[model samples]
Target: MTEQHGSDTGPRYAARRRRGGIVSFVVGLVATLAFFAFFPGMPHVIDWGAVLASLAVGALARAGCRAWMAKEAEKEGKRIGHF
Candidate 1:
């Protein structure tokens, strides 16, 4: 006897996750850049390497936020094709 499986949700979930990740990254990057640009004291407080490191950290944070949001969306059955 053959066992039938239901719909495969992985691709849909991943697509949504990727889209959310990109949006989050863009927003976070912009905010970070603006903050650095507008805060006069910030330049003196951080070196070039530190600034680069912070940017990397911000990227990771954005990715994490996106992943969390995607997971939450998946839990709520918010798959891309569903809506």
Candidate 2:
């Protein structure tokens, strides 16, 4: 059996990318909530727009991580194929 040395696995990259997105989304949501909670009578009303914005932030984080990782892999001469 032959194994590639100093190479990255596609699944690992995918997982990392996904994690980045999830973490970003959670953080954004928490921050949004905290902002609203800072004032009295804020928690009584839920802001749907803030929730949607968090989703957007999450998507952007995932995309940014994917692009950055791919670029780094290319720079290192490692070809990370689609998984």
Candidate 3:
């Protein structure tokens, strides 16, 4: 029931890179700032919808990158990291 990977080093050496909380926080901060900076019109009260949407977009972008990397790795007979 074991899954086989193409590399001779095997899964043991196919270590996943860990993305820290700080990185995620920084990304979110930059994205939010950029959105507000370009779009303008920030309300006195926090706009939950805009905040959520920005975060969702960032998350989707990250997911898409990982998926693309995974696909590329598959083609190259290699495993992609989780991060």
State the lDDT of candidate 2 residue by residue for 4-75, as single tens digits.
Answer: 436355566567766766676677667665665576766655488766765666566656666777788778
Which wins on TM-score, candidate 1 or candidate 2? 2
Ranking by TM-score: 2, 1, 3
- Model 2 scores a TM of 0.60
The candidate that wins on TM-score is 2
Minimum summed lDDT over a 10-residue window in model 3 is located at 13-22
Residue 57, candidate 1: Cα error in Å is 4.2
Per-candidate TM equals 0.53, 0.60, 0.52
Report how far off residue 43 is in candidate 1 (Å): 4.9
Residue 3, model 2, lDDT: 47
Encode model 3's per-residue lDDT on 43-78: one tens digit a residue. Answer: 544367767766776666556555665666778777
Winner of 1 and 3 under TM-score: 1
Clashes of each: 0, 0, 0
List candidate 1 stretches off by more than 4 Å: 1-8, 40-54, 77-83
Cα RMSDs of all predictions? 6.2, 3.7, 5.1
What residue pairs are clashing in model 2? none
> Could you tell me how far off, in angstroms, the CA of residue 15 lies in candidate 1 after the best superposition?
1.3
